[model samples]
Target: MLEEEYQPRRELPPHLRKAPAPEAPFSYELRDAVLADMPAVREIYNYYVANSTVTFDEDRKSLREWKSKFTYLQKLGMPFIVAEAPSGQLLGYALVSPWKQKRAYRFTVENSIYLGPAATGKGLGRVLLGELIDRSKAAGLKEMIAVIADQGAESSVALHEKFGFTEVGRMGRVGYKFERWLGTVMLQRSLK
Candidate 1:
């Protein structure tokens, strides 16, 4: 796990934090996520965990925990990237990791994505996912899948469809939060 004291400075400009308008191009660059991205990544993720159903966990995670997660992904040789604006502010990030630890499941991986609040509805998620899929395919993964919260919107479903992923299954009431239950949806895209 990465140390809690780890805080890598993003080597980009500073004006990128401006609130995005309806049509500012929503420009972003897809690049490998470095140690410097942990703070922004943690901010985006914690917001979701606390206010949205994107993930099932209830307790808010600490920076140390996020660092450990990044460390784990690095150790697994997984592909992780941050979507950044011209000034280096992070828009979002995506990654592919093993779906299961069993050797039989090594050929398959699951996908995850999180975008900054201001960056939503700007199409950055789609671009980030496209880059991630290309990298995963080039890495020789046989299949890539997404496990999304059942209550997720059509945009998410459509994004996967645009990339050739189709609904594989759904688990009812698999997650409980905000005083309610939510379903889990699984979708997959084949690289082979």
Candidate 2:
């Protein structure tokens, strides 16, 4: 091997290193999601599906699938909302779906929240979740559940806990994604 190839990589001196670019100021409003927002919502979700363990879905979802989900939530009178920038860009989304199809489970729902990469860590999740809880309560939902991945999703766990969700149970090695076995942590909160 050449000497250049054998040499270890060198780090830049602190003074010579480039600083990270400052994030642009951001703001958004939350509203009920429309059919038109499916494309943007799909994009945000597919990003996590393709790049992270946040979601166990390995295949990218199609627009048709998103549209179907939107319609299903609509028919069920579930809360499906989005955060939009002043310029009409979707920053994130939150929704609740029936936790189970059994009649006994009608009053319980599973919550899902996803944010665009640039929209995370800016308090958007807190706002979205807070509003989702309020809407679910208004809709007569009595229980909300969050199924979060055990790996690569610590922030999600913390966020749910902040909203008073408590660990109900856990399933180990229930998912296989990205060449690894994954597990889930279940958290529950009461609306009543």
The prediction achieving the highest TM-score against the true structure is: 2
Per-residue accuracy of model 1 over 100-165 as CA lDDT, tens digit each? 999999879999888998899878888889888888888788899898888865678789889999
Q: What is the lDDT of residue 32 in candidate 1?
A: 90
Give TM-scores for every candidate, taking all chains together and pairing residue i with residue i: 0.84, 0.87
lDDT of 1: 0.87
Q: Pick by lDDT: which candidate is best?
A: 2
Question: What local lDDT does model 2 show for residue 93?
Answer: 99
Candidate 2 per-residue C-alpha lDDT over 38-101 given as tens digits, one digit per residue, 9 for 90 to 100: 9999999999999999899999999999999999999999999999999999999999999999
lDDT of each: 0.87, 0.97
- How many clashes in candidate 2? 0
Candidate 2 lDDT for residue 160: 99
Q: Which regions of candidate 2 deviate over 4 angstroms?
A: 1-24
RMSD of each: 14.3, 4.9
**Where in model 1 is the C-alpha error above 4 Å?**
1-23
